[model samples]
Target: MRIAFVHRRGGDDEAVLGQAAALGRAGHDVHLVAADADDLRRTPGYATARRTVTVTTGHGGDPVAALRALRPDVVHVHHVSADPGRSWVADWTGPLVATLHDHHPPCASAGLHRDGRYGGSRGARLPLAWASRGGTADDPLLRRADRLIVLSETSRARYTRAGVAPERLALVPHFVPDGTRGAMRPEPVWVYAGRLAQEQGITELLRRWPAGQRLDVFGGGPRERECRAAAPDSVTFRGVVEHAGLVRRLGRYQGLVLPGRFDDGLPLVYSEALAAGLPVLAFDGSPTARTVRAEGTGTVASWDASLPAALRAASLVFPTLRAHCRARYEETYGETQWVTGTERLYAAVVRAGAREFA
Candidate 1:
């Protein structure tokens, strides 16, 4: 099938591009429609695509016009701004599939971390209620899609409660290419590879970090200065590492640390860590923590005195969990599974559209 993926050149565009590459590798003709040429060139999936078409909405270039010209059988949208007026999906009337990488219309904050709590006190119920009442700008656009791809069960439930038909929502988690090249002994050091922010629990991680435990911090964010000041001598700030480079280096660490206190619908890093055969150390109440506990892929701990014990426990079992982590990745979060499932969804949506017209 010919598929055209539309991305708005946002933070999560790499995942979308990676999915396109996965589909391309599966023998489907895939084209990327994006706004930035530099990103298209530097990103991992660009080189593998059949073709790429750049769209400049500010310069009078219509994305719908460009997509219509391509005449793809399916149009898959990855990430677009929440504004219906600015979104090109509003004008497209074809077999369309949209992936919601974050909680936007239902949470408003998108990250679901509000007032220093994950999903606030009421979780997504309040925002979902607001969305159900047509309180969000993107509600209409979200409803218009032939299918809405959610990355986690939490997201699927939130959208469903927001009045999206159950049939329209598909739970397809993100996938990452395997980063392990053979097997290498891991060091006793832990790694954190995302934004250094309060909501991510970086501040709490630094404050409550066990003494003598080595942690390498990657990426930069709003709390960099605060985190740096509060960080113990055992924690090293490695600055921002490119995604490819980070994935390559993941296996060297004992485990990936996700201290975030939010229910971040299946972060891409989770897949990357699993791909590298690296276990994760996630905080309690987060989605990653739930997966870690359920899958035996890593350690789940609270942001308290018990965290040190959890760290020690993870160290003791790290060797055994490494293979299990990789196995879980292959079974659930690998490119092949994701691509096949997505293809099925694409075919279903296309068949549904055909039946509607028939």
Candidate 2:
């Protein structure tokens, strides 16, 4: 089958590249159509894709024309805008599938975090929800999708409440490549790797980080410098490291600390940590914490007033969770399972679309 995958930019670009490579290896002719060439180059798997195509659509280029010219059997879109007036879905034809990386069509902020938690205090979220309203279960653009892929059950439920048709949603967890599974550090040094934004809870983590354990911070974002300046001497800001190097460093940590106070659908860093046999430290109620508890790969701390106490408590049991963490990775996040499940989804959607057209 000829498949074309599209993404606007960022980490989603790397995810699509991974999918394209896996599908290509499975004997499918896969093509990647993205908006960012620099991001494509940074991703290690992009080189393995059968073909890579970049579109200037976001600026002034015609993505519809590029996609039309390719004529793929299936068009799988990832991380693209869903605003009714700006969406590319209306301009394209064929079996259309979308991976909802976040709550875009429902919540304008996409993080679904507004008033100190997921789905803001009624006052804040109502306006954004009103602006991006998809209009019931029969939303035109969303309904047009043959299938909607999400990273977790948490995401599927949230999108449903936000108005996407439940029938169109499917839960497909994110995948991370196998990493260097080194032994956990004997002394319980921790690491926080990802964007340094407020929604990520970096500020809160730094403020409340237990002085007993040392933390190495990785990745660069808007708040990197501010967080670094305010952080304690025990915290070391390593800045941005390549994906491969980040995973290697993750392997040596006792656990990955994600103090994010928002509703992140599911960040790839969660998968990366587990792949390296590192347990996760996330707040309860967030998708990351839910997955960790469900899989028994880590501990979940309360996001409210008890966070510091929870953090200290999680530190004590971190070593015991290592084996469960790596084993869970093999069962759920391995590349082979991801590829096979995705191939089935693609074929099923294509067949259903063909029947409908006929």
> Each prediction's Cα lDDT score?
0.75, 0.71
TM-scores across all candidates? 0.86, 0.82
- Report the C-alpha lDDT of model 1 over 227-344, residue by residue, as the tens digit: 9988889999999877788888999999899987876666778888988899998888887788788888988887655777888988998889899999999999988899889999
lDDT of 2 by residue, 261-353 (tens): 677577778888878778898886687888878888788877556655776777788777878888888888888888788888888888788
Model 2 lDDT-worst window of ten: 53-62
Runs in model 1 with CA error above 4 Å? 36-39, 42-45, 50-62, 84-91, 106-108, 111-133, 136-138, 355-358
